[model samples]
Target: MDARPLLPSNEPDVASSPLAVRGLTVSYGEKPALFSVDATFPPAAMSAIVGPNGAGKSTLLKAALGIVPRLSGTVTVFGEPLARARSRIAYVPQRASVDWDFPARVMDVVLMGLYGELGFLGRVKAQHRARATDALDRVGMADFADRQIGQLSGGQQQRVFLARALVQDAALTLLDEPFAGVDAATERAIVAVLKTLKADEKAVVAVHHDLSTVPDTFDHVLLVNVRRMAEGPVATAFTAEALQATYGGRLAVAQLDRVAPR
Candidate 1:
């Protein structure tokens, strides 16, 4: 897969970014997870959110999408508030956070992505099924459409969730650790689909854990450790200094050499 940056023809102003977070903060009880973090993910770009464990990387996404309660901050999608732009965004949560025993077939799970468009009393038509099937095929899960989600391997489950996000055809796609437990082939499939998304002028933002894959996978990176450490193009912002500041001593020296060798 070609991971080269595919810049958008007409870049929108900062205010019109696909996703823009301002003064975002989240807390669990008295513990602050994210603190006044501000970041912007541009259209047609693949961005990664990276940090050490418990560094509020996931919290930032949850807070931005209103999945978790925010103590203070505002989230805007395509220059509009979340409510107005909710349909334009698609989210794939952490695979570990999902319950595989939900008793839903792979097709049923993928169809759930259309519920926003289906609405109350809206029926699932043939075209909707076709769309779901196309999304499944893209992620190499079309054959497992009838299989129970719980019966899938860890990598297959991740691909299914990604297919779920694909059906939405959202402009801004947010994923939490899409490659966490997936096999190499599954990771390649996911990366290919993400690159396709970028080629189509869509924005992809994910909470990524593998620093080594950062340069090869994402063109933009936001380094977070309870706050916004650094953010911008991978060439400049994904430097050794920013990574060190983001991971501190928690990241092994050898790991740094692979990602941001000086």
Candidate 2:
């Protein structure tokens, strides 16, 4: 497993394996989401996992997080086997997957970030509350800490989710569609927050859809459509052919702007 920073920051990213997948295969009943997928996540970098809908983007992340069963392959995090490093990874699921009407307050949800270490029978302690508040402050959501999740805007809800992930204090973060329905300004704010994570030397990967923003925001990209089409540096793997392959041969990328950096 290579731990080096995948993207070159202002200074060259030194290597330290953050996450690695080798021959990873995942299936849901008879259908397969990933097939023999092999990849590595560079430390301290933001990686865009781009793919059309149902291309197994979420499945791959789930497999990595041990939420879904993987038919084969191995995942390792921070130089330790994934199962052994479970406590160091944070996952922010899609907002659409949750019920905002559940009636939980933002601060309460954020405190769940500490539940992994707190044991199932234990309730959130005072220290956990402090950490949740700190995370909300970092995301500029301190004022809305006491608001019910249902009352928040889409962007505000997303920020709360990010705060939850941050409160985990994990070394690696996986976000599924964090920018999907947010406003442009919200998108910018989220991207800025992700950049801050890189500065702090944490690896963050997002399941992204917008093609125009990939180059400007991501350093590495995993182009997927059902199976792995290409995985490499953004500039090389996000080429016209790669885009077409990942888009299921529907996009006329050959005539599209090829000058964009991957």
* Among all candidates shown, the one with the greatest lDDT: 1
Candidate 1 off by > 4 Å: 1-12
Q: Which stretches of candidate 2 lie over 4 Å from their true place?
A: 1-15, 121-126, 258-262
Q: After superposition, how far is residue 214 of candidate 2 from its true place, in Å?
A: 0.4
| lDDT comparing candidate 2 with the true structure | 0.81
For model 2, how does the per-residue alpha-carbon lDDT over 1-262 read when each residue is reduced to its tens digit?
1212222233222235577777889988898888887667778889988878888998888898888889999888876787788888898999899899998999988988888878777777788888899999988898998899999999999999999999988889999999988998888988988899999989898899888888889988887766667766777666766776677667664433743433
Q: Where does candidate 2 have its weakest 10-residue lDDT segment?
A: 1-10
C-alpha lDDT of all candidate models, in order:
0.88, 0.81
How far out, in Å, is residue 9 in model 1? 21
TM-score of each: 0.93, 0.88
Give the TM-score comparing model 2 with the true structure, all chains together.
0.88
Each candidate: how many clashes?
0, 7
C-alpha RMSD of each candidate structure in angstroms: 5.2, 4.8
Give the backbone clash total of model 2. 7
